[model samples]
Target: MMTSSIVQRVSECFIKPLHPIEDSKQISYLTGWDIAMSSMHYIQKGLLFKKPTTSPNNQQDFIESLLKKLKYSLSHALFHFYPLSGRLVTHKTQHPPSYTIFVDCSNNNPGARFIYATADVTISDILSPVDVPPIVESFFDLNKAINHDGHTMPLLSIQVTELVDGVFIGCSLNHCIGDGTSFWNFFNIWSEIFQSQSCENENDVPISRLPFHYRWFLQGYGPPISLPFKHHEEFISRYESPNFRDRFFHFTPESIVKLKAKANKEFNTTKISSFQALSAHVWRCVTRARGLTNDQKTSCKLAINNRLRLEPPLPQEYFGNTVDVVSAEMTVDELLQNNLGWAAWKVNVAVVNHDDKQVRKMLKEWLESPVVYQLGRHFDPQSITVSSSPRFNMYGNEFGMGKAMAVLSGYANKFDGNVSSYQGYEHGSIDLALTLTPNAMRALELDEQFVNIVV
Candidate 1:
């Protein structure tokens, strides 16, 4: 657990107007999509630090110093310093969507933060493990601590666990503020500041002065662009009641290599990669495991950053949401009948030239639809939030400790099979974290063909 003094001190350094975006600005033609893409909220990556020797006695003080330096470093990173214009839809009482941070000082490790908390901060965990699997132990503990409901932090938590080796630092952030690429950009800067290799200055923050035009976009685009209600109950439920879920899975390197090799052969395209194949394959696995038939239609919403694809790629420092979703739809039959390669092919079709006019219009309509408009506002962190995009993996996000072994959303807030894939894992295969209903998981296992292959 961390101390209030340290939290307070760090808060004092970071909680101020580190970056501000005026509500009146209008985003440029392509940039408007950037803000819209970023509007989709998710959790930032989970970070693990080797327990420092000085931590045992003055644990809290050490944490405070680290946080103060972290905040100062973030203030210098271009991504953290940009402005936001996605706040037009927020309720008056809600805090503006710049960078909001929350903290949890609980006695027990909760393991995940997207759901409601059932415990409190009376004392630290007595049953804490002495030898945790270095990264995994700190990862789970931090989730348990920071995801607690009463507290919300812009920078998730700087958790101190009772490890045999030493104290480990766990840091998290909310994705609504920045993507993994942007987060790493800030982290690299933060590391330099920590080492005193770079000096902090107000000008170090990026200029997020891009024009924002929600009103104009809504006015210029009509009908589907204005979220429509197909049914009152489903439409209203998004606001009346919201649901979210998340879950994680572990895979050895061998499993991923087999899947990738199979995908490559099946697709008849050596260029077809694991992310494309596995994401499609898993979507098929889970959707099928959930008993969705081929006749039914489902959409695979993938995030595509418009930063470089736009007429003029957004300024490297232009930090508001600059992503858009490229979705692919298939009948359950088509998905069920196809091999991983077929699925990969379909995914390739959906993602290639993803920003094409028809595809963009379709995506715009879905986001503007009444169900999404209402539900997105009341989205529950505990409910499943799916982000299968590999942009985070493609972006160079190494801090001093080295690139993250795996990264999950700090804001996903649920255990319902919210899935993510990361680069540089144990070996040839990819590693993924997924949240799935217990029943669905069991069903997959009970089905001999699917179960025997992966396990």
Candidate 2:
């Protein structure tokens, strides 16, 4: 529902990269995990900030200075995360004839795209309520923000929107290159360089952890599996449901505590964590809202970060995708009829089952018969995909201006049954942003359990 009228002319658009890579044509093969994500849409992250109280004597000078710093620091950050300043290349001439993909990290390739534009909106326009603001989509250029063509779409695209009293920094990165952790790692480093005002001496900055880019670690004990293009096509078709809408729901600390206690009392068990309790409550409410048959099976799919769960933990900075999906399913009647604690227990069990051995087994199985997109087959109107983590310091990302007033998901085209979570602007609170079919969303808004917990 956003229109182009919201965004003014583009002030600038160009490619930014670190110092030229020595080899202009080096190729890096993607892991099975990366190939699986390649078919999905780009991951969009946005940070909004209020206008600085103190500025240069002139307005134009202030804007120019800010842009210069952003571009410079971003280029320097690319030095540490080099694969981002490249493109995804699909090989059509493999011996066995499969769509093999790899990262073309050559210096000659177009680096990350940087765009500057002006917007005729304010921070309040987008973040006034807990619900997702309509203008959120208008804050960035979606058409060019994510390159659909693997050959030409820059691996990363950054769009900065200058507003009357705020700024919106939007980043779109190919999911195949890295997951949310990798994206935020690059973002935090960029902010560090910008805040330090030391683009020239970026090397002098001490990095607590450096990214590990050798993806061979993900390979398991088996011949490489062939990932076919047809799989992605089928994956897309499965979730192409109609009348979906995106909305955000806020849960204050007090509500979360109360929900946890209530869930525990339901089954007389005290082990459910906040995440489990909350996810269970939401899953139950959503299923009820969808009006599924009692005998139908409903599932909740959670993306578990395997960084720490691996037997020998991956390097803190292993920069590629290290997430594995863990799902819990129950008949619609059981999910609806059970107490909150029963649902939470099911969720907890699903997570606990994903131990190191299970993680390795899953990876090995993926290697034997690789399917890039894993969620579509089990995904339906009765399913939910939960991503992002409240533990990530989304609000701490600060450029020279100040900390972000709000963090947003740039990829709002999320289908129904998709949920993303983040730390709330207010401490001790959690924000749950979800996309659901229009009727389901409307029913959820009126549901007593949801209304009681939502702020």
Candidate 3:
């Protein structure tokens, strides 16, 4: 939806690591986890910042200075997150006619991208809307770019858009390279390095967490896991459903506590986490707003982190995707008739039960017959995928000038029943971006039960 008429692209360049890895260490293999996200579109999201008022210079000077700081800090970030600078390439063999997908991190590989642009929009335009403005998608150019396009496209791209009175630092990262965890890790590091620019000693800001590059693989599986699908089109869903709408809703800390307490009290246990309780509430409210009958079926595909679910737990700093999509299913009556605790318990059981053994079993099964997460393939009108967690540090990213004003995502990989949660601008607050049918959106906006707690 972005065009040159609306957002002007001033300049663009590829950014590489300041200290490159040797060509041998550059070719990072696609782990089973990474491969699972290979065909998925680049994750599109970014932070919004108020324009710096301290700058005494004109707009041109401010733009140049800001770009310099961003490029410098990003270079340091790339030194550690070098995979972001590499490209994904495919190898075709003649004898067997098989193809292999890998990251081309050789010296000849093209680096990541940094684009500087000026927009005629404002922060209010993005933040004040009940529904995110469609023009916000223009903040980044990777609107429809999938990870497979990494062969030709930059695996990672950062687009800095200078708005009338604000700035938007948008990033488009190939999903195959990492998940939301990895993306934020890289982003926070970049901000840290950026903030340290004004310090007396740049070395004072040491890299707090070094990422673990080892990809996850089943113990018995080959290093090169053979995927069941041959071509990208096999599982990619091209049919875009019309009449869908997206809405932004927020839940404050007090509301979160209340939701969790109510859930635990009803269950007569303290096992239900705040996230589970909140998710269950959202699922119930969304289902009811859809005007579905009591007998209609519904499902919630909740994505869980597997960093600590392995036999030998992965480090907190482990990079790449270890997401496990746990599916919770029930009839409309079961979900709506029951209390919030009942629905939450259903989700909690699925999550607490996915321990080491369960994760290993899922990994082994995937290795045996790999199934790539098809683009918009998980179809069920009543099913919603709740992804991106409140645990992700979304609001604390500070770069000296000030903290982020808000968080916004671009139009990529979004479909009906897709929900993404982000930490709000304040602590203990969560913002949910829900995509639903246009009619459902209208109902949800008017649904008193759903609107009462929304901040």
Task: Find the candidate with the highest lDDT and give its number.
Answer: 3
Candidate 3 residues 1-455, lDDT tens each?
22343888999998777676786677777877788776577999888899876444676677787888788788778878888888887665555544567777765666889999988877877787778887888898677877778888898999999988888999999998898899898888888778766423344346878888877777777566555555656645443446578878999999999999999999999999998999999899989888888888898888888998886899867878888889789999999989999999998998899999998888888777777776566556787889998788877777654888888888877877889999977788899999998888888888887898897
* Model 1 Cα shift for residue 329 (angstroms): 2.4
Give the Cα error of residue 21 in candidate 3, in Å.
1.5
Query: Which pairs of residues clash in candidate 2, taking residues 3 or more apart in a chain or in different chains?
Result: 36-372
RMSD of 3: 2.4
lDDT (Cα, tens digit) per residue for candidate 1, span 306-413: 556554345544443455556666777877787888877777777776654544565456454422222235322222234544434322333333433334344333
Error of 3 at 417 (Å): 1.4
Query: What lDDT does candidate 3 reach at residue 378?
Result: 59
Each candidate: RMSD to true structure? 9.7, 3.0, 2.4
- What lDDT does candidate 2 reach at residue 304? 89
Candidate with more favorable, higher lDDT: 1 or 3: 3
User: What are the runs in model 3 whose C-alpha is more than 4 Å off?
Assistant: 1-5, 54-57, 93-97, 198-205, 228-230, 235-241
Candidate 3 TM-score versus the reference = 0.94
Provide the lowest-lDDT 10-residue window in model 1: 114-123
Which one wins on TM-score? 3
